[model samples]
Target: MATVRRKCFISYHHADQDAVNQFVRDFDQAHNCFIARGLGEEMPGDVINSNNTDYVMAKIRERFLADSTVTIVLLGRCTWARRYVDWEIQSSLRRGQYSTPNGLLGIKLPSYSGSFPERFNQNLSSDFPRIDCYARHMSYPSSTSALVDAIEEAYQRRTTHQNLIVNPRARMSYNRQCQ
Candidate 1:
């Protein structure tokens, strides 16, 4: 039997490029999934304008994730705090004009220390209750097969978990910086 290659969007903190690079390389070597698109250092803007923001986000949807079937989030130290990552995740979850909800997965980098961004904080209902816990994890580095399985699982979830919608509470904000 042949391994399935999913169209995967690589989401990561700009500060953690090397980790995601290695992940891409490994996935390619194994034919686990295709690196269909990526979210890198390009920020929305220094100033927040709704029109520009909407335009940029639309471009992201059309260019980056419009064809992807899954989004593999490489969770580095500051990934949880980055607004772009939140926006990417939010965008990935929509079943709208851009694209249907892509499968979602979160991986903890070697530097992970259990602190996650509010978006992944499964238990923040009082503040902004998230869908909670679908993020798979491993303490050490992840293997290609592991990620492939995760991608497929997330793909499967889009059908099973109709509850996975954009959480208004976890919305991204440019004014805030990670502490």
Candidate 2:
């Protein structure tokens, strides 16, 4: 059985770069399970410096998040506190005039613990009926199939349960204390 490949945009703290790189190498570069886009991939390392939030988000949506169908957040020890991660999540969930919202998925890195990103948390709900959730949070992928399944599930939710998405939270202006 062949695994399905989805276009995935990875969101992670720079602190978790090694882990994120390893993950991409294993699941994407090596196995070709999915198309990976993030820092040093499709996304640029530096964003425009400006006080205008709308401009920045528009640039991000146009350049990085436009083609992605799923946003894979790599949750490391302090990934939840990064402001950029919050914006990325916000951009991923926002429905643009041309693109629909990307499926949000949080993958706990091997070193993950402590708080989660507030914006990412907004879309992730453990309680079910499950109608109020737009994302899935889970531990690291055990195999290519597991990761693909999660991505596919999220991809389906873009159309199946998009109404459940909660993306109205104000964007975080600064990183919070991890503890």
**Superposition TM-score, candidate 1 onto the true structure:** 0.76
Write down the lDDT that model 1 would get. Answer: 0.64
TM-score of each: 0.76, 0.88
User: Model 2: per-residue lDDT, tens digit, 1-179?
Assistant: 66668888888998888888899889888888788876644334455678787888777777767878999999999998888888889889887576689999899998898567888887877677754678888889988788888999999999887887788768888888875
Model 2 CA deviation exceeding 4 Å by range: 41-52, 126-132
- What pairs collide in candidate 2? 80-117
Q: Model 1, range 22-123, lDDT digits (tens) per residue?
A: 666666544545554665432222322354666767777777778888777777777887777777777777775534577777778776656666654541
Q: How does residue 157 of candidate 1 score in lDDT?
A: 71
Error of 1 at 68 (Å): 0.5
Q: Quick one: how many clashes does candidate 2 have?
A: 1
Residue 106, candidate 2: alpha-carbon lDDT:
91
